[model samples]
Target: MPPTVGERAPDFESLLCTGETFRSTRLDEALDGGCVLVFSAFSFSAIAENWWKRYERAGWADFDVPVLGVTRDGPYAQNAFLRYLESPFRLFSDVDGRVGEAYDLLVEREGMANTTTSWRAVFVLDADRTVTYAWVADDWISPVPREEVEEAVAQL
Candidate 1:
């Protein structure tokens, strides 16, 4: 099950495009004075990146907190995806979905052959690493309502 609203978040370490390492344990260190939004992708969904860019341009990055883009792909693939979408947020590789699994956000095929794609999900975490908001998109084309995230962060 996912962490409850007031529960401590699970910590995870993953590689990022910045050549730096990250994990939920370091969330507070990264956000110190700001909030964070973890955007998880199903695969190569550029739409998600587009939505985040809107927030980035709207001054979300000005908060100085890290907005992490998490995926199951490695840093090499993530680099390509970010470059193609002109994404500003750093991408973190979940590789085998351990992080997703810990958060109860892992979505894998039941009987399909060798499928590894994860379901699209988003989680907003405060500097304390507690999950403040969560959403799972129903489809690849579904957009993450900007105000929903903004309003969540505004609360922090």
Candidate 2:
């Protein structure tokens, strides 16, 4: 099962596509004094880009909560997608799907492995790595509305 609202979030590290060597970011460390929003997606997909744009444009990054984008794509594709969207948030590469599997966000159906790729999902985590909210979309085009994320952060 996926992490629930009150459950502890799984901590994982990934490579950032910052051109230099990938940096390690521990979820618990990142949220040591604030909340975090983790978005799991396939790079540059319409829904992912659109939602990320909205959230960033709203200045969520400047707030106490940090937003993270995690994807199964390698650093190359992830960097390209971030450049295309002009997103300031760092994107994490989960090429092995270990991060997604740890969070139980991988969905394999009809012999197609969305787990091996990326599907739209979001997790809100508190400072101690406890999950405050979690959402995994059934369709790539659908995302938890921006307000929901805002509310989650506010609640944190």
The clash numbers for all candidates, in the given order, read 0, 0
- C-alpha TM-scores of all predictions: 0.75, 0.84
Which lDDT tens digits does candidate 2 get at residues 1-156? 778888988888777665333566676655645565555667766767777787788787876777777887788888778778777777788888888888777766446655455457777788887788777777767656667777888887
Local accuracy of candidate 1 as per-residue lDDT tens digits, 51-148: 66666787766654567766777777777766765666777677888777777766655565675545566667776687777767666557676677
Looking at model 1, residue 100 earns an lDDT score of 74
Instruction: Find the candidate with the highest TM-score and give its number.
Output: 2
> All candidates' lDDT scores?
0.64, 0.73
Q: lDDT score of model 1?
A: 0.64
**For every candidate, C-alpha RMSD to the true structure in Å:** 3.4, 2.5
* Backbone clashes (count) for model 1: 0
